[model samples]
Target: MGFDTFGDFPTTALEADQARRDAFVADAGGESIGVDQLHRVLAAKGIAGNVDLVAGDICETVPAWAAANPDVGIVLLHVDVDLYEPSLVVLEHLWPRLVPGGVLVLDDYGRWEGETRAFHEHFGDDPPPVERLPFVDATPVHVFKR
Candidate 1:
């Protein structure tokens, strides 16, 4: 499960940072080039076998979308929505739907503005076990376990 935004809808710095982070994660294994590149990354990573990659918003029919494929091993839940209400709603709706030990990567989570602070407020002190990664051109993106 993943969400990608050009950050056009929410014209905030935080939102733009979130979009960059999303691109970073997707490009990490070189999955940004499309399905063929993603397959290559999977092969190079030695991640053979059945895998389901959900690359879209949590607000979209992700539950149903993921359900369409039952053999998914790892569900990488990447969320880049920077709005308070939308981010919270996405987490609330999608968190419960994730399988055990799934990964949730929230992008641009350290922004000082209230819009970006929503990630912390919604997750609080013990949101999940997260690892923060600093980026050169954008805010840090936090990786969490579900």
Candidate 2:
């Protein structure tokens, strides 16, 4: 499952202002473009049924989804939320659901200080070793659950 507050910051005014200041929107359509592209790619690969996209604040959606799907164990979690609070929320809600040997990918790790700080803060002092993947735009890091 994936969570996002799409459109021209339809969630909150504060978030919209922040997005404008940060120039966070990749296209004119905002995050909806990314969501659409993801769907298109998934459909092309014949894996559209495997993924579910949730539109809302991660802080609210993640916990709600977790409670509703108690039996679900996440094998791979790819988090691209560029803010600290949401990143931390996703980790708090989903990290425990990740089974052993599961992998977690932080997509905005080095690109955004908030995201980077959230990862470190979530893991604390005894964080697992992360492998940084070489990418042109964002610095993504991954770690496997022991």
Worst 10 residues of 1 by lDDT: 4-13
- The true-versus-predicted C-alpha distance at residue 79 of model 2, in Å, is 0.5
Per residue, candidate 1 scores C-alpha lDDT tens digits across 51-124 of 54545444454455546755655557677555555566666656666678898877646653433566677777
Alpha-carbon TM-score of each model against the true structure: 0.49, 0.76
Q: Tell me, by TM-score, which candidate is best.
A: 2
Which regions of candidate 1 deviate over 4 angstroms? Answer: 1-74, 112-116, 135-138
Give a tens-digit lDDT track for model 2, residues 76-122: 88887667778888888898888888888887776666667777888
How well does candidate 1 match the true structure in TM-score terms? 0.49
